[model samples]
Target: MSSLLDVEVKETIDQKTFLTFDLDKETFAVEVEKVVEIQELTNITPIPNAPKHMAGVQNLRGKILPLIDTKVKFGLDPIKETVDTCIVVIEMEVEGEKTLVGTLVDAVQEVVTVPSAEIQSSPSIDAKFDLDFVSGMFKKGDKFIMLLNLDKTFALDEGDAADNKENQSHAKSKKS
Candidate 1:
């Protein structure tokens, strides 16, 4: 048999396992290592000056993190009070730094381990929702769990990003 050592074969891929959650009828997931904790649905303090998708702030063990509605981010209908809603707190790394961010979902399913071999780059999805936030897709059993690139999902535009950078820098200085 002829040897086949192509570039794709020579390169190794880095994959992190993730936990799946449901929104509307679709299933999705984010890196498990990035996830801090999944909290039950609770009162979130609305922020008067926050962005449209931001549900508001929440205090977890004395640490504050912005709670973002996945429905809002995906342009879904407004969420009504339900028994299954929850907040999946994820720690994301953006621009070479890490911070905690919580995402509200319709319901959270059990965690499913996805192997690196099972992941593939996602293609252009229909424009109904922004697909740029999706890093890839992984299949387990008969389900497809869209892997969210949290960094890209939380990517802020110039002004807001600049404000975040300033805040981060100040925080860094205080720490040092």
Candidate 2:
């Protein structure tokens, strides 16, 4: 699979690789360029001082990689992961460098090709989950799959996480 050199910042492309998956009974698609590799659920090594959304790191073919639980990022209750859960390894171009990140999906459906014309801009969403993370919506049959901006979804940096922890800790300390 070839990495689309500029999918992170630019959204003006025609054909796109859609990796569809189920999230809370809804289907979502992340650009295929964002996906490094899809693998069956594997053991994750927890890292201290890591972001809360971070599920931990996993070893894929001897590579240590970070795993982010999308549920946590979206402010939803964490789903009890089962054997069916698989990690979708994503490689994103962040700040001019390609970084690898993984998100655990309930189940991966398939990789389908959809032209850019079929993707429609995000409509106003009234949920706590940020709609900006969604690039567009694609319809298949009576169902619609939200095409996700994986890079934007899992794009938190260490500095941002540290600042968040500081704020959280300050808020906690004041509660005492």
Candidate 3:
């Protein structure tokens, strides 16, 4: 009886739930623990002098949430807005601070429990864009879902931020 109990506990530990979503032609998954909530695509106020990858900011239940274009971040062209388009609110640790950011995706699919044994290492492909964000992948039927490393995928470099700030200040000074 003890051995059976041990097997059950181990099996539970070995499976992880992931929230899968579509980004263009590829499907990606992120651990559900990091996901906060999903919001339908709404009016996003554009930020002045922001990076190209930043879609803008949205009011998520009175809290301001920064929206990021996942397609542009991955070096893919932005997808047209449709009824299925939505924002995936994720909690990511950036520079030791927990920040809530919304990522725009083509669509959100069902949540799936994937076993650890089925996950494979990221493939070494000569792709146009960097695959450093992908931690692992697993096959589900005919399609494979790439597991994303949240920290790396949504990393904000301090240098880039500082530069942008400096440029903005300089522009303001020039206008004055």
Candidate 4:
């Protein structure tokens, strides 16, 4: 009885769980082990002179957690916050320290269990944003969900993000 239930729960030996979210119509996922929690969109204190991709900071319990706009970070246009908009709090390693950052997503999908063999390397293709942050991907139904490398995607280098945006703008101007 009890043993049977335990065996059923332990069936995912070769499977990993991921927390999925949506931005625009594309889907993205991160390992559930890296996700701390999810919260509905809350009042965010805007930071002065912060990078455009940064949404600002929010109070998580008693700690101040910085928030990043996932769409903006991926070079996608930011959409107005709706009822489905929420924050996915993820634990990332930064400068040898463990830190928590809240990422804003259009909507959270659900936890999905994927077999290890199903995950594939992302193909090199022209995309709106750099695919370096995508660690892997897997096709589901008619859509492919990219798995994000939390550390790379949410690196807390404010100056580097601003510099990258500036450099991209310069390149675009030069092309004109």
User: lDDT winner among the candidates?
Assistant: 3
Residue 167 in model 2: lDDT: 63
TM-score (C-alpha) between model 3 and the true structure: 0.87
* Lowest-sum lDDT 10-residue window in model 2: 6-15
Quantify all predictions' global Cα lDDT against the true fold: 0.77, 0.79, 0.87, 0.86
- Please give the lDDT score for candidate 2: 0.79
Tell me model 1's lDDT, rounded to 2 decimals.
Answer: 0.77
List residue ranges in candidate 3 displaced over 4 A: 158-176
Residue-by-residue lDDT tens digits, candidate 3, 36-138: 9999998999888676678899998898999989888788897679999999999987778888999999999989998899999998897544688799999
lDDT of 2 at 63: 75
Tens digit per residue, CA lDDT, model 2, 1-176: 44677664355456688889987778899877677788877778877656667788987678778888887777676656877788888888888988788888888999988767888988896955678678789888799999887667878866547956876787788889
Shift in Å, residue 44, candidate 1: 0.6
Clash count of each predicted structure: 0, 0, 0, 0
TM-scores of all candidate predictions against the true structure: 0.77, 0.79, 0.87, 0.83
With a 3 Å backbone cut-off (N, CA, C), the pairs that clash in candidate 3 are none
lDDT of 3: 0.87
Better of 2 and 4 by lDDT: 4
Better of 1 and 2 by TM-score: 2
